[model samples]
Target: MYLRRKPIFFLFLLLHPVFINAQFFADRLKSFMSTAAVSAVQYPKEVKEFYELNSYRFSWLEKQNAEQLALLSDYIRSSPSLGLSAGDYHPEIFPIAAIHENDSLLTEISFTDAAIHFLHDLMMGNKAEPLSYDGLKYVPACYNAAALLNVYLSPGRFANLLTDLEPKEAGYLAVKTKLNAWLKITSAEKYEDVAVAVSKTLRGNKNGLTRLYQLGFVASDTASLSEPALKAALKEAQKMFSLLSDGELRSTTVQALNVPLATRIAELKNTLNTLRWLHCVKQERHVALVNIPSATLLLYEHGKLVIESRIIVGKKSTPTPTLSSTITEVILYPYWNVPYKIATRELLPAIKRNTGYINANNYQVLNSSGKVVDPYKVNWRSLSAGNFPYTIRQSTGCDNALGLVKLNFYNPFSVYLHDTPGKSLFGLDRRYFSHGCMRLEKAMELGRYVLTGNAVAIDTLTEKGCLKNQSPITVPATEKIPVFVLYHTAWIDGTGMLHFYEDVYNRFSPGRKP
Candidate 1:
């Protein structure tokens, strides 16, 4: 017993240092968190009182602005934990800055839309550091002021907002600046109370033929939409329509609505009414692929999922056929397989540039039907452009258009994932450029993401489509991955707010008013 006790005592002595260090680290983390909480508690009231008196004083709330001051005092007191601070929460500065500068018209738009959008985007998983600074530093003061400005500046587009001013702009903008964008969205008033009423007002402003014309425009463009977001927007619009009576919208009493502005507004609203409420703003915390409107691919990295990424998709006309797809494989140094369209359309033209266009590019032509045609016997130019048979294949080398990688997926459409030389387009808001094949922005990382049980490999394929290789429809991979192209502009998020994005495609979808 004594011998066993001696050994146990020795072991504890050996382990004691590690246990004490862990406890120390744990205490350090707790101390920092506690300190952060304390710091956050200090200055929100100063922020709130400051926000209200300056912006809402002239609006409808002006008659009672002073009476309402104490109501926000409690909220103002709790704001530090909310991240409001001095060199910090100078609330109205952002919009005023834009207004004062006059250069950033985009920011000139009611800052709440942008601010709320930014917050929602952050919550949905976008990087939030820049937004955090802007929100805390610029939004509180900017919120009500910007809301007033959005209505004031674009009355034609935002006339209904005059009613929204009733709610405390400080509370509204607080949600906008402090919360994530997704959460702010769900903060909308009940649909029947707000959405239906707005729709009725906008629609009532128009006459019959104009309304039909608007619906006609919506029906014509459903083709541009990919599922889910469009479907959801349509759902919300229809519901909003039913909530208000036809008479309410068409009441002959509303005189100004009968003007041309009302007609256009009605048209846009009618089209907007068709959008459905799909699962957008993925607060569901899903890891699925998201397609964007205006026809681009978005990978929801964080909560808001609005990162501008580059992708090469099918070209227009012979345009990469549009359809839903998921990412499945990542290949390095991908060999280019001259697409059937490219083989027939582009190769011959290149050969004219030089017979070597084929030999030099590692591409060889096939003849009349499906058989390989000799480059020697055919009068390449005289051949009818439409009926030409051969295929082109390139032997692998450095000049391959596919560049260093490929991400492949299975789609009935014969479309696959690949890399491109154009790296610049990824940063654009509109990324509709591509030829049926999907291009990746982070090829290497995406490749590693989808790779399966194979040797954790990063191998490159050298069989350039320019060569004489078998033109198999499917390149059997040792593994497959899941990649999808989705379009989600709004939905209840983790915080349960309906987040919205710009209807980039404008395809039969609109951000239905809250």
Candidate 2:
């Protein structure tokens, strides 16, 4: 009797759509969250939260869900067009997994996993290994795991969310488009060699000129005057690379041109990663960004750049730390509270050479109690750097290295942006000459901007100097402006022109391909 009924019961279960779909969803969830699959990665918590939020339902199982999943898969596969790798997000295992009526559960799980990983990479970058620099303070795009799951699982919003995850900064997008165009055009061609034309006009390969034209550095000069036009093209290309516009296609220029497309793509990826951090941050009406690699500070008001000035960053040895902080105050005629490293390595030697160097440089030596010690009476030879306990303070005067102003920010690095009397350094295109602090070319203008966020304060400060003819005046900001000290080797400008700077500190190590 049991055997006779078993066949009919099995047929009933097979015919029931609800029962079949339920089993499919369960199988998909189990395969997706399998310990062997997700145990090694970072998304277990996120995956768990995702499934729990939907009560273990298959996210991409239904027809409507599958349609959205298809769109997402296409986007993931086209990552290379954006200078990213689809493989970086494990698209093979899930996001682009083929969905069928049978094993639809596994396919749905795979697709959901792929979407999560893709979003994570888009928002946080695909860098798996730890970077060497701890100085970078990256505030990653934050999201609640369950909330993100709900959005990605939602049929109406999932596609839009994928679109929104991309970095929308004009410069970043311009580079992305430029890279895509380059890849598209060069897809069929072999990498060609650029001939060196150092100290002379280019004679070999008008192909170089064509390359430059394609790269958007040269305007159309149809008149067949090769030397002058090519020279102009070289100069423009040099300028784009942040080199002196000498108008000669030297070995360096050739080398820069010959940098493999792979290198540029990697650089674009790095820039994209950095841009993600900026995109995730709270957009402030007024802010200052110190791009370390460019060695420039850009001041923005209402998201428009008000001014840009050359800056001196830390040397490669003592690199400037990347961080996000707020500028709360500006000090005019600021004192240079010398760091211990400087006191030992720099000042100690100067004092040993000439005891008078202390007074001549307007530096005062003080004990821990703040009592000034006469430099002449102190035994300079006996004071070793490690054993030294006194603080070296430079007075507010013409010779002071801190110059006329200092923009103070809150950070553990104890570094601030300040003025330098050695303005000649600004003329040099490569300006990585400071200790750890940033030396601003337009310190007075920046100080005023921080204080008042406009030109009024700058005019008053320039005309009358600080209040009451004071040696030092501390001006508090009415609203603290957000400051980001970042390092980006490649970026685009307002005119959609790409700019590449030398990696002074070698912050980006092109590890294994993404």
Candidate 3:
């Protein structure tokens, strides 16, 4: 009994070192607050205290030579990165396993269990929902990408979004490409029986694998599935799914089963005949493309539109042209140019009357060949408002129409998204206030997103030298990422009550008649 007591004494001493060391770090943090006024919108103090205690526990575990405890400590120390608490594994914020049914064969499923456990923990509310850093700040971002998919598909299931593509139209269209690849692996040309068995297991299982399979197939851009084609597709999916761990799959298996089977799939006949079934209904963008009442921008992802605030858009006289585009280039310090229309109508008339008018506004005179002519060398009065064929380029620096940054995308309209120095508009409920470019409130966050992501370490296009005119770099996405800019006059807020915003663009109710 005396000998046993000695061992306990030894353990106490081991933990003493960790306790003493951690106290110093905690004091330093408290001292920091003394010197500075605390920042507004800070996280709860309990959060900070928990992390500090995690450090102390980590030290104590390390001294005891407990590797598992030490690892747990490490996770606690880096809780922000792990998105977990000390010795705690939340079981609900995410999914346990995700079962995707094979597309080609109507009865097969693809299982990915590795990542499901972590996701399942998050979804169960066992852990803190981690925040995502959006450039300059952080906000509550979803921990589970799969859960995001669930939220995404909630309003309208997979088949409903693709009303444009008929079941027979799956040959080479971009929308059908994803399905074609998936079908190649799932149909089991390589092992037909295995494919059928897999599908049967998913459908028969209570876990919703069948629905996932259905969703995956519907989201794809394929028209038909053959045994060989589907087998090939599943092979690819298997490779992608292998990245997760077994424990994860076990956790989210339940969430994977929760999906709404979606309206009457088996009833769609043409899809069955082609060894493929696709929903033939589509919801138009008209409803999503309208405006809100307040002065803010309505944001959208995929086809589902949600209005956050009301915003101003370019006047229709010089209306913003709608087109397919992505942010390609982001200029840190931007230059403004007098658009051709403005030059021809506004500046040209002034130049014809007052010679010094061009100099006063800092507009540079340029010839037809795009060469800058000295302001003094050219006869400003010689150019008539109707003959304003020459270009008027604005110099860089302050007072430029565009703020400090501008995002460029390829479009026939030569329009670029940007930030404006006129912050007054942010307060106005009616914010439709641009010539013809997107003005973003969260432009910095957009920049951060564009800069971070996966890229192939292929050939270095350019090894050295400063790269100006930074063109848009296309990053092939492994998962579906949707972006939408929309306008809605009415939407449900947190309390689910309908809210309205000012339709500054007048796109919602044309002429504001309603």
Best prediction by TM-score: 2
Candidate 2 lDDT over 1-514, as tens digits, reads: 0011223223432343433466566656666676565554446677777777777875654543545655565667777776678776654543332334554444445656666776766766665323233333555546563557576556566657656666666776777776776676457466443333344556455656656755656664233546776778778888878887887667667656655555666677667666555544435467777888889887777656677888999999988988777888887778788999989998899889999998887888999898889888888889897789799998876678888788898888888899888999999988888888999998977776676645465566577643322467677875687788877778655444678887778765442111
Error of 3 at 265 (Å): 29
lDDT of 1 by residue, 1-514 (tens): 0111123223432333222233443344334333333233223233223223333222111122212222222222333323232122224432122122222212212222333332222222112212101111211231333334324333242332323332222222323332332222323354111112224333232232232223221342213433343334344433323222233333321221222222223322221211111113222232234243333433333324433334655443444443343455555555565766776676778776667666666655655464656676667787446866566655444555665666665566666666566777776644656655666676544454455344245432332322233232223344343334543333222222323334344432332322
lDDT of model number 3: 0.37
lDDT of 3 by residue, 285-358 (tens): 21112122232333333223333433345655655554333445556546567788888777777777776887
C-alpha positional error of residue 262 in candidate 2 after TM-score superposition, expressed in Å: 1.9
lDDT of all predictions, in order shown? Answer: 0.37, 0.68, 0.37
* Of 2 and 3, the candidate ranking higher by TM-score: 2
lDDT of 2: 0.68
- Give candidate 1's root-mean-square deviation (CA, Å): 23.4
Cα displacement (Å) at residue 107, model 2:
3.3
Can you tell me which runs of candidate 1 are displaced by over 4 Å? 1-309, 318-322, 325-332, 366-377, 427-429, 452-455, 459-480, 487-514
lDDT score, residue 412, model 2?
A: 83
**Weakest 10 consecutive residues of candidate 1 by summed lDDT:** 129-138
